[model samples]
Target: MTDVPSSDIAFTPRVKALQAQRGSRSAYARMEERGGFRTAVTPELAAFLAEVDTAFLATANAKGQPYAQHRGGPAGFIRVVDEHTLGFADFSGNRQYVTTGNLQENERAFLFLIDYAHRRRVKLWGRARVVQDPDLVARLMPEGYEARPEQAILFTVEAWDINCPQHIPRKVDAAAAAAALARLEAERDRLAEENAALRARLGER
Candidate 1:
């Protein structure tokens, strides 16, 4: 029996078999030899999380029933607590609590983060826990955001990998696009005034 590589937390024997069948195992094997997915947050990953205002969190119950929940707030809402941990304030929503219930039964979780404007995505596998401490929740909460914090969820990352930007359609944030349009309008007005002055000067000449 071939021992599993320590850095390869994502690929199981079944997954490897499929890769081999598809003729892609050798490339992955080379990757494994270098070192598989990253287990700790690097500088690049930390910067990416800073601009991520949205994420999808996936969890499963003890019975293996899976659920994915959408989480969103201002940029930097998902804060990196440390090299191995991530945290965010759990805002009150519809009170369904499906994610909370699943976590109680199963700690294993996955975080999917995508930056539409940049056409980049990241996948992280981790274990998560919910904290009801008011102090911790307050610390993670974003100021000036109109949302009531119900609690906090802390995730300890096990392994993570970034995917290529292929097939990711580029999109811009609504607020950012609006700001850019405003700047262009202002510049157009200024140029219109300059053109009128130049016309008057030519007439005088």
Candidate 2:
């Protein structure tokens, strides 16, 4: 496999240098020619993102200090504004504001969306800015969720890459599991009622 990612990838000089020292530069260069590196979101990717309710957002300040935060909501909380743009409603949380502050100094951001049950994940690199437009924020908000939308974050696509499922432990979404349980209970109740109806019909006969 090539060790050098595609040119669209946000691989910095420092990362390339490390790759050289680690003897992965040539492998990456060969690997760069293949894979789902894209400058815009594809239809399959949009559908994948719609199912992801959680992702890890990484940001760095002007001084290069890094901060990572977990963002989540109901499924499809992240909105695909276009093939090249993504938007999401930023909700109120612990008043830390690290992500907000970092974006101010440095717009560079990276996102990791993982489907643990399927052991699949996607990596997105872009520039992000927070906006307070009421109309846009409302459009991005997840329906039926109680979180208070504070603002909206728009991420301009630079590049994106899909990662292999290696090392990812198989896990299930809690909400999906709960929904499955509800369906099973409904099925059980329906069968019970049918049995009772048959017993009553036999007694009368």
Which has the greatest lDDT? 1
| Count of backbone collisions in candidate 1 | 0
lDDT of 2 by residue, 119-171 (tens): 98999988999998999999999988999999999998877878899999999
TM-score of 1: 0.95
lDDT of 1 by residue, 39-149 (tens): 888999999999999999999999999999999999989998999999999999999999999999999999999999999999999999999999999999999999999
The lDDT values for all models are: 0.93, 0.88
Error in Å for residue 25 of model 1: 0.7
Q: Which ten residues in a row are the worst by lDDT in model 2?
A: 1-10
lDDT of 1 at 60: 98
